[model samples]
Target: MSYSIIAAELHKALQDQDTALVETLASELNPADLAQVGHHEPASRMAVLLHCVPLDKRAATLGFLEPQEQLAATAGMPVSELAELVAHMSADERVDYFKQLDRERQQTLLKALPPTVRDDLLKLARHAEGTAGAIMTSAFMAIPAYYSVARAMQTLRLKGADVETIYQVYCIDTSGRFLGTVSLREIILASSENQLAELMTEEVIWVGIDTPQEEVARLIARYDLLALPVLEGERLVGIVTYDDAMDVAEEEATEDMHKGMSIGKIEGGLRSASLLDLYRKRVMWLVLLVFANIFSGAGIAYFEETIEAYIALVFFLPLLVDSGGNAGSQAATLMVRGMATGDVRSRDWARLLGREVFVAAGLGLTMALAVSVVGIFRAGTEIAMVVAMSMVLIVIVGSLIGMILPFILNRLGWDPATASAPLVTSIADASGVLIYFAIATAVLGL
Candidate 1:
C-alpha cells in the first residue's frame, strides 16, 4: 500500500489504542516506507508507534528519519529502550545517533549498554565525521586465513545473520592484522579441503581510518567494490559498504547542486527545510549578486553620450546582456559538474579553455548572424556591423570567463561549485556592457 494509506491506518490504530493492530501494520511496512508513514502522523503518535516495531527495525527506521524527526519520535523514551535500539544499530549509525543526544543523556544511554558495546561505540565515535572510520560498520564478517573452505562456510552459517553484510568476508591473522578478503562465491566453489589463504584474494584494497569519505566513495565506484576495509595501520577496524557509499554520493551531490545555484548548503532535504532556513541559505547570494550588478549600471552610465548619440542601442541592451549571462551560466555549470565527477582537474584547464574558445566562436558566429539581420532591418549597416561584432566579442569573453573562474577557485583551495552560475552571469553582464559600448564607439565612431 502507499505510505499515505499506511499512515491513515496507523493514525486510526493509534487513536483507538489498538496495540496489536499497530504492531501488525508497522511490521508490514519496510523501514524506509515506515519512516515516511511516520512523517504524516503526529509526533506523539509517531513516538508511540516506534515502540511497536522490533528493535532492529526501529533502529533501521530511525536512520531513515530526519534528525529532527528522530529526536521527536524518541522523546520521553526510556533509556533502557534507547540503549537496546542503539545496540541493534550498525556501529556508524549508532555513533551518529548518539552524537545527536546531549552529553548527560548520552552518558545515561551508554551506561545502560553492555560494557563491550559501549567501548566499541566510543572508539567508532572518535573518528572525525566525513572520514572512512566514521562511516564504516564494525559488524563485518572476519575469519582467520587458516580456516578451510568448509570451516569458513560453517562460520558464516553461525555468524552471517548478525552482521550487516556477508557477501565479502575479511581474512585476518591471529594478531588482528588484516590479511586480505575472500568472497562467498569463491568459498562455495572451492574444494572443501582448501584453506582460506588458498582461495582468498590477497591483494586487498583498503583505506586508512582518516581517509575522506568522498575518496572512499570514489574508490568503491572506481573499483566496483561491494565493501572496502578500513584500517588503523595494519589492523582492520571496520568495512564501508556500498550502501553507505551511495549515501555519501547523494549527500555530496545535493550539497554541490545547492552551491552551483548560488544557494548555500542546506541542512536537510527540501521537504524538511523550514521557510527561515530556505531564506537564510538564499539571501546572502541574492544580496551579493545585487552589489555585483552595480558594475553593469556603472558601465552603462560611463557610455551615456554614446547611448544618447545612438538611442537605438538601448533597445538591444537587454538582449545582449541576457545572452552573455546565459552563455556564461552554461559554461560554469559544465565546469562545475566536470570537477565534481573528477573528469576535469586543475592541470586540464588549458585544454578546457581551448575547447571552450572553439565552441564559443561557433556559437557567437551563429548568434551574431541572426542578430545582425535584425540590426540591419531596424537601423542601418554601421549599427548592424557594430551589433554583430559586439555579439561575437561578448559571447567569447563570457564563455572564457565562465570556463576560467572555476579553475581559479579550485586552484585556490575553494569549491569549484562556488563559482556559481549567478556569480558567473553577474560577472559576464558587467563585462558584456563594457565590451558592447566599446565596440559600438569604435564601429559607429560615437
Candidate 2:
C-alpha cells in the first residue's frame, strides 16, 4: 500500500488505541516504509507510532529515520527503554544514533546499555567522522586461526545470529590480530579436518582504521567486496560492509552535485533544512556572481564607441556571449565529473589540455560557421567577419578556461567541483564581452 494510506491507517489505529491493528500494520510494513509514515506524523505522535511496532522492528525502523526525526521520536523515552532499542541496533548504526543525542542523554544512554555494548559503542564513536573506523561495524564473524573447517562451521551455527554477515568469515590469532579470511563457500567445500588457516586466503585485502570513507568505498567497489576488514596495527577491529560503502558513495555524489551548482554544503539536506539554512547555503555564491557580472558590464562600457559605430554588433552580443557561457558550462561539467570519478587527475591536465585545445578549436570553428550565416544575413560582410571571428576566439577561450579552472582548484587543494557552472559561465561571460568587442574594434577598423 502507498505510504499515505499506511499513514492514514496508522493514525486511525493510534486514535482508536487499537493495539492489535497497530501491531498488524507495523508487521505488514517494512522498517523504511514505517519510518516514512512516521515522518508524516507530528513529533508527539511519532513516539506512540514507534511503540506500536515490535521491539526489533522498532529499532530497525528508528534506524531508517532521519537524525532529527530519530531524536524527536525517542524524546522523553526512558533511559532503560532507549538502551534496549539501541542494543538491538547494528554496531555502526548504534554509534551513529548515540552520537546524535545530546551529551547528557548520550551519557545516560551509555550507562544504561550493557557493559559490552557500551564499550563497543564508545570505541566505534571514538573514530573521527568520515573515516573507515567510524562507519565499520564490529558485528562481523571471526574464527580462531587454529580452528578446523568443522569447528568454524560449528562456531558460525552458534554465533552467526549475532553478527551482521557470515558469507566471508575472518580468521584471527589468539590476540585478535587478523590472520586471513575464509569464505563460507570455501569452508563448506573443504574437508572437515582441514584447518581454517590452511583453507583461508592469506592475501587478504584490508584497510586501516583511519582510511577516508570515500577511499574505502572506492576499494569496496573496485574489488566487489561484501565487506572489507578494518585494522588498527594488525588487529581486526571492525568491517566496513558494502551497504555502508554504498551510503558513503551516495553522500559523496550528493555533496559533489550541490557543489556543482555553487551551493555550499547543506546540513540535513533540502527536506530537513530550514529556510534560513537553504538561504545561507545558496546566497553567498549568487551574490558573488552578481558582483562578478559587473566586470562583463564594465567590458561593454569600455567599448562604448565600438558599439555605437556598429550597433549591429549589439544584435549578436547576447547570442555570442551566451554561446561561450553554455560551452564553458558544458566543459566544466565534464571535467568536474571526470575528476570526481578518478577518470581524470592533476597529472593528466597537460595531456588533456592539449587534446582540449584541438577539440575546442574544432568546436569553435563549427559554431563560427553556423553563426556566420546569420551574421551575413543580418549585417553584411564586415559585421559577419567580426561576428564569425569573435565566435571562434570566444569559444576557444571559454572552453580552455572551463577545462583549466577545475585543475587549478584541484592543485590548490580545493574541491574541483568548486568550478561550478555559474562560476565558469560568469567568467566566460565577462571574457566573451571583451573578446567580442576587441575583435569587432579591430575587424571593423573603428
Candidate 3:
C-alpha cells in the first residue's frame, strides 16, 4: 500500500476512534516502515501495532522496532503475548530486549514464558553480547539423517512456521550431531521415498557460537547460502540466515558512522535521541576538541613577533590552515570507510599510506600553486612563496596524519572510525596553524 494512502486512512481511523481500523491498516505495511512511523506517535502507534499485528508478525515486527519503541510498546503486553513473542524472536533481538528490562521486570517476563521457550531464552541470554552466541537465532529446521524426504517434509510443515528459514534444511544424526544441509528444492525434486541421508550433502559449513558476526556474514555471503548453522561444541544450537547476515552488515556500518562522530551508545536512531542525550554524547569530545585548539592558537600566539614583522603571514593563515583541515578530512574519511567495509585492513597499511601520501602531495601542490598566485597579488613575491610552501608542507603532513591515525587507533583496540570527522579535523587545524607560522619565520626571514 502507498504511504499517503496509509497515512490518510490512519488519520480517519484516529478521528473515528476506531482502534480495529488502525490495526487493520498496520497489517498491510512493512514492519520496518511501520516501526519508523510508530516511533513518531509512541502511545497511539504502539496501540495499533499491539492490536493489529498477530502474534508471530508482531514478534517479527518488534525485532525491527527502535529500542525505545520496543520498551514502551511491549510494556502492557500480557505474559502470554510476551512468551509467544519470545518464541518467535531472534536471539539478538531477544537479548537486546531482555537487557533493557530491570531485574524485576526481567524476572517477571521470564516467569511468563512457556517452559520450552523460557529454556531457550535463558540459554541464549546466558551467552555474552556482541558474539556469535548472542546474535544467533534458536529456531532452525534440523532432522535426523535417517528420515525420508516425506518425513522431512512432514517435520518441516510442523515446525517451519517458527524457524528463520525452511528453504534450507539441516540434517543431523540421532545424537543431534550436524550431518550436512539439503535445499528444500532438491528435496522436493527427489523421490518422496528417498532417505534424507541420501539427499544430504556432506559439506556442511557452520559457525561456532563464539564466532564474530563479521565472520558469520562473510561465510554466508561467500557461500551464497540461505542460512548457516550455529554449533555449540558439536550440537546445532541455531542458524544465521542471509537476512540476519544483512542486518549485521548494516548495523556494523551504522555503528561505524556513530563512532566517527564520537557518539557514545545512543540507540533508536537520531529521532529518539533527546536534547540531553545528544548533549551528553557530544560534550566530552567537544571539550577535548576545544582544548586541542588552544594549542593551535598558542602556536600562532607564540609567533606573534613573527606575525607582527610579516603581516603577510596573518593574511594567508586561514587559507593555508583550512586547506590542511579539508585535505586531512578527505583522507581520513576514505580510510575509515574502507576499514569498516573490509576493503582495507592492517596488512594494507603500507600500501594505502604510500598511495595517499603521493596523492596528498599532488593535491597539496595544486592548491599551494593556486594560493601562491593569489597570495603574490595579496602579499607580494617573497611572502607568497612562503605561504605556498607552508600550505604544501602542512597538507602533505595532514594526509600522512590522516592515514596513520585510523590505523593506530585500530591497533590500540579503538574503532578506526572514532578518528574521523571532528577529531581528525581538530587535529589537522592545530597542526596547520603551527606549520603556517613556522614557515613564515624561517623562510620569509621574519
List ranges where model 2 is wrong by over 4 Å.
1-20
lDDT of 3 by residue, 231-253 (tens): 99889988888887898878877
Badly placed stretches (over 4 Å) of model 3 are: 84-92
True-structure lDDT of candidate 3: 0.82
lDDT of each: 0.89, 0.91, 0.82
Q: Whole-model lDDT, candidate 2?
A: 0.91
Give, for candidate 3, the lowest lDDT window spanning 10 residues.
Answer: 42-51
Residue-wise C-alpha lDDT for candidate 2, range 252-303, written one tens digit per residue: 9999889989998876557678988899999999999999999999999999
Candidate 3, RMSD to the unseen true structure: 2.4
Candidate 1, 168-239: lDDT as tens digits: 999999998999998999888999999999878888889999999999999999899999999999999999
Put the candidates in TM-score order, highest first: 2, 1, 3
Task: Give TM-scores for every candidate, taking all chains together and pairing residue i with residue i.
Answer: 0.95, 0.95, 0.92
* Model 1 misplacement above 4 A: 1-4, 11-21, 274-276
- By TM-score, is 1 or 3 better? 1
